[model samples]
Target chain A: MTKYQRIYQELLDKIKTKEYKTGDYLPSENELMKTYGSSRDTIRKALQLLLQNGYIQKVVGKGSVVLDSERIAFPVSGISSFKELKESMDGTIETIVEEFTVVPADDKLKDELHMDDGNVYIIERVRSINGEKIILDKDYLNGNIIQGLTKQHAQDSIYEYIENELNLNISFSRKEITVIPATKHDKEVLDMLDYDLLVCVKSYSYLEDATLFEYTISKHRPDKFRFVDFARRSQ
Target chain B: MTKYQRIYQELLDKIKTKEYKTGDYLPSENELMKTYGSSRDTIRKALQLLLQNGYIQKVVGKGSVVLDSERIAFPVSGISSFKELKESMDGTIETIVEEFTVVPADDKLKDELHMDDGNVYIIERVRSINGEKIILDKDYLNGNIIQGLTKQHAQDSIYEYIENELNLNISFSRKEITVIPATKHDKEVLDMLDYDLLVCVKSYSYLEDATLFEYTISKHRPDKFRFVDFARRSQ
Candidate 1:
């Protein structure tokens, strides 16, 4: 393997083993060059490969820090509150909410979202991995969950606003996931390029009172999606 | 919707809500005709739809029972014991262990399976869903896990055979899953009818003693493959 490739694997292994965790600043190029005995160009190329693979990110003045892609992954088991997950992950992960509006809830959605009657707030978002859009979430929340919703609030993580601003306790939830042929709407929303199927993660979140807070439908590119679990024989 | 469609949905809802669990025999066809106030043909059509959609199964002498497809699913937090999961739910989820042979362990396999310059037994099998081949699994087990291994011993769940037959504690695991363009071997093993990408689930299973018992590579056709999770925000 090439010197650069070897460095890349070494760095990846370090990250996987949590030797370098999310939000931890990596050594500068000059320092890496000195330590690895590599040329400047070789060091830059290796860093670039890691950056492109969602391993690390660079800031304008600040040095490169590990990205939190693995930190917020929703393992396939029970549901996760996106807000709580981000907060516990140290709040470094950011959200760019794109759209929010109140619309008439349809029959299917009414049942799924558990809306009593009337208009519901629909929030749309593009979740990013170090600034690159990865998850396109479209949520239907009961209007009663929050009275006033704004475009600005929608741009960030809704979970943040829900708990930090609205003070709602996200207790538990369930999810049903399925694979479907990509619809034209999914392509437009998710900007999927090469994948044929769209993995749909449909989940319902509830408040501590057991009232449904939001029902979300997430469309992810098949290539970038993974759901992992550990299992054993039940004695 | 037709009467049969309505009946199908009603039964599906019952199954989803656990009114009818896996292995619970459904009411007889004549009984269903009375309950739904529908003709025998309508009831039959509803049952047929359920079978096709993997909701229920029919036994030769016994009546139809709900099929627990979700019961044996991989858990998000822990490893799933396929044998225990199958036993928890009704119906015989059979595993046909096809091939068992020993080969020199590769460097990567050695690292993952915790082997050191030793022979590794490779086990290959096609897991069927109600007699229809669905999953193609290839496992590299440490020769030390099962002292004596032959093709016949692996015909059922290897984990079961290892634990009950040989007494090994299959414990926690880590996994990495990805979607890749189907290879020629994938097509042959999965018997792919259509050209599409395959979702690969790869994991290393560990014993309680921390010895890696198996390294698995399972491939599934996208349509039949699903990984579902309900994640709550980290506390």
Candidate 2:
């Protein structure tokens, strides 16, 4: 391996092995430079490799924070928030805030977020493309980190508010993509047409410190959704 | 933008605009080298970017050929054939050949394959892990290109035969990943316990010369399927 690849692999190996566990910050750039006896650019290149490969995330004030390694193993493609994903496509998109409420963390939310007890923000939004409600997103967020999430944030980009306004660096996410028979909730919110099945992308999103900040389930109409990929023959 | 990045984008824009249409080979490396007034290595770097980003595919005797740009827009992840995909996961996998036959391409097949009239080979295979069948793959191939396909090839790896033995380069593929209600055919082939929905990945694979060579639909039990993606917050 080249120098940067070696550095990237070593850090990744340590992260995967849990030698440096999740939410743990890695050594500073100076420390990494000293450890690898490499230049700043070389160290940055290695760290960038880790970042793009989803092994770590760069926080504004903090150093590189280790992300969930298990998620790294299963990535199908690059991950982007809804806004970024849709902005690239040609569409007149609108978000409808169906519901926004803050409630005390239930047992399930407490367990999922790994928190003792605190209020959680629940935001439900329906995304319409070309005047059709094709996507429904239900987000459960830790109220502590994402304080005072307004209906505007729910209607717009929640990730934008968390990252820009809240000054928190959103890190990696563990996503589970599946197709399921639509529930009553899906039927009530989405333009279900005649399709019985829908695609669901459930994401457990973490912050720079690897705190589980949000749990989002985005449901899509089957015909309106497609996950495309490119492949070259692997040697 | 960096020089290589600029070159990559220019080429991509051209391809997307159909300035260079599909099935059209890109300019020779020497021609690009002269047009850009760069070294062979620098020219190559730009070409490599095109190849990786799914803009073009390299053939053995031919140069880089443009891939279907529309499919490039919808890519959810990297495309890997079944054998490559399953081999990456932990499992004692087995493939059972259910059926293999060659028949004249019907009108639907003719339209799908973009060929006037020719024989097409159909193969159905069941993929099992440990003991339970979890995946059913149906493949249709242009018999003129994929000549002399055998039961052993279907039982093993068809891509392997097409690449290694047949000396035909498997190039880029346009993929559609969706979840659909299981058909009666699926019920007969797969050991579907109770799930009514399944994840279907439809792939239209091409050869290096940009020839439509194969079309495959692989169905997986939803619980057994997950498409993961890694996203660094896009700026």
Best candidate, TM-score-wise? 1
lDDT of 2 at B67: 58
Looking only at chain A, give the TM-score of model 1 against the true structure: 0.58
Per-prediction DockQ scores? 0.18, 0.20
Supply every candidate's count of residue pairs whose N, Cα or C atoms clash at under 3 angstroms. Answer: 21, 6
What are the root-mean-square deviations of the candidates from the true structure over C-alphas?
18.5, 18.9
lDDT accuracy of residue B104 in candidate 2: 99
User: Taking the tens digit of each residue's C-alpha lDDT, what string does model 1 give over A80-176?
Assistant: 4455445544324556666778987788768876676777888878765555455778888887666676777676556678777888877555566
The per-model lDDT (C-alpha) reads 0.69, 0.77
lDDT of 2 by residue, B201-223 (tens): 88888665556788899899976
Cα error, residue B33 of model 1, in Å, equals: 46
